[model samples]
Target: MDRTESKHVFVIGLDDFNLAELQTVRNADEYEFHGLVDYDTMVHPPSYPMDAILAEARETLANAPAVDAIIGHWDFPTTSMLPILRREWGLPTPSLESVLYCENKYWNRLAGQEAVPECTPAFQGLDPYSDDPVGDLNMAYPFWLKPSVAFSSYLGFRIDDEQQYLQAMATIRDNIHVFAEPFDNILQYSANRAALPDHGSGATCIAEGLISGRLCTLEGYVHKGEVVVYAIVDSLRASNNVSFFSYQYPSHLPVGVRNRMISYADTILRHIGMDQSPFNMEFFWDEATDRLWLLEINPRISKSHCPIFQIATGASHHEVAIDIALGRKPNFPRNEGRFPIAGKFMPRVFGDTVVTRVPSREGIETLQKQHPELVVHVAVNEGDRLSTLRAQDSYSYEIADIFIGADSESALHDKFRHIMEVLDFRFSDVVPTNYN
Candidate 1:
């Protein structure tokens, strides 16, 4: 393809690190790329003018040549923003209502109940702004609570007692509306949004029964209303908290379990009317009962797993997102990459602490030298407070992301364990003092 004539794609939230993986797409040579928003703005935009960011997104795209496609793999704003822009420019993408069916937690559960009740857990939406926020909930204590629109499990909490519930409500009251207001503003433009359960602009949240089992994600895309699953990635969490420790592609799940998950996802995606986009759906499988529970369905590829897919399968799943964006059928690879298995591991600290030290780029380089297949990315600097990291989950702080490949699952974990020891992350406890 000639450079001047290449198709122009505006990737809403492309980050520097993931660019390499996108370059390996089979259609890479046929397109040119432009990035619209950095990660921070995409995650949490300034609140003074909720629609200002969307205006800027429109302006940015307008300045470019006719955009062949608008694509993104980030959740929230990206998923929301993509459909909005597509509608504006008369481009092809999933409808905003379809995306919302996957985003709005309360509505998503409602749709899931109708389409896959066997996989849906008991849930109820709560208005955090109410005088008695806890009173509106039908679910009991020990249930999980989270906002209707959030990313990376930002405000999610597991409530065990009234004290914890009260504490969580207080936090939600102060923070939940930030994303909600903007999401509601976007919904105003959707002709199909009115029929869905009104989530009141995302300020509200949901409390659901806890479903525990082996966690994994199905990565795929819908083309012309057909749901196709390309891969499954195991989401391994830290022993004590909800933060993910690693994501391994070519899940080690039994074939029977994997098949059922794919089937369940197909029914739900089709029922909700999601098409012409990449999707990531999480599920939990109970071994003893042999049941699969739906966690949540996200309307984008899991960007964190892109590199691992490339390392283990020759190409990243970004190919699917890109292909679908351009209105072409995706041609995904199978058993094509260097390693049999690959993982993206997170090294986290579970408490509030001040960073005293972290590995330098040079130090990471040395470790990568030792382990030729390793790629280390540190998110903190010396003297930076861990709590100040933007978009961090309330319970834990991730200091670094380690990507690696191995011949087997056990070897992949062993490699991650060895790398964690080599990368030094030192923190000093922050003495708590009431500031109010």
Candidate 2:
């Protein structure tokens, strides 16, 4: 609770939005955050230059005033590079190998099966480029297929038959390199690469048996071998059950279900050797059979849910990561906000289209004035085409992200619907033209 000087910390893929959230954490005045690299260089670029990015970061750090801590919140190469940077700076953080275990979906499922087979779904790895990609999978149809290293379900798909498998693999074979090449760059750094499956690589895919029901994420940190989880946020999905619909804090899942999730998460993280780091683990609860399934684990704070946490917990969950990066145990308070519930809503459209108009900045600001808890981030502008957007999930194009606080779930939905209606986004569908 006392400090004589500021601690300079560096954030991978830092942006103005999250920077504002980071500043609201405890002891904000005592911390100075330097953007290790801008957000667009990592997310907006057509391809990642992993080696060049690393070299630039190292050179920049070499010239900084101080490097007390390093942390990241985005998916790879941010997650993959955070451990690498921390190790370079001699700061307290998880080993890169442990992070790789979580980043590689194939390896992550393998570790989960060993630690919690009861909750682990059946999964098989496949090299998308192999001559017989579908034959490599031993599982039946109606499975989820995805690139091992992609985020936001960029290339993920559901396979119902052999025909669909081939179609998806064709797409993966063509576009997987956008993420894979950069990810392969990460794999070369692993001293224990041999210990993992040699057949495993970023270009590969994982086909997993379907698991469904209530979805939620447990967010916390492991400090000195102790894995502590402080929040379980519910993940509401679109009717299609693919893209995320919204995230609500202080999940309404049963207390018993929540405890089981925490127990399984602790066992798996310990087994994966994840210590001295922040992580968020996802899970699904099948209310029909009262069965629980492990979805995936991320070795960073949830960047999307950070804002909602600010309203629900009175501060962004980034506080947990900042404290951990500083080698201090997380002391994030819970349920201390003005509202009873808070959420982040992701509204999307299904087809390729061009944006015609977006809500005016002044109009959004006027709404924010009335509802201080509300924040709208418009992703596209006038005349922007949806298909060209990078890192979007296969099914839909997310046009904007809405964050708000409400007293109940019904209230949350009403608030979000009304907000979107007021924002009044206009779009024109793109028509396909036959090529001769």
Whole-model Cα lDDT of every candidate shown, in order: 0.83, 0.88
Model 2 misplacement above 4 A: 1-4, 429-436
| lDDT digits (tens) for residues 346-387 of candidate 1 | 888877888888877788888878777677888889999877
Tens digits of per-residue lDDT for model 2 on 303-420? 8888888888888988999889888898886667868899999888877889898999999998998899897899999999999887788888888899999999999988888888
Error of 2 at 24 (Å): 0.6
TM-score of every prediction relative to native: 0.95, 0.96
**Could you give me the TM-score of model 1 versus the true structure?**
0.95
Residue-level error in angstroms, candidate 2, position 200: 0.9
Error of 2 at 21 (Å): 0.5
Give the backbone clash total of model 2.
0
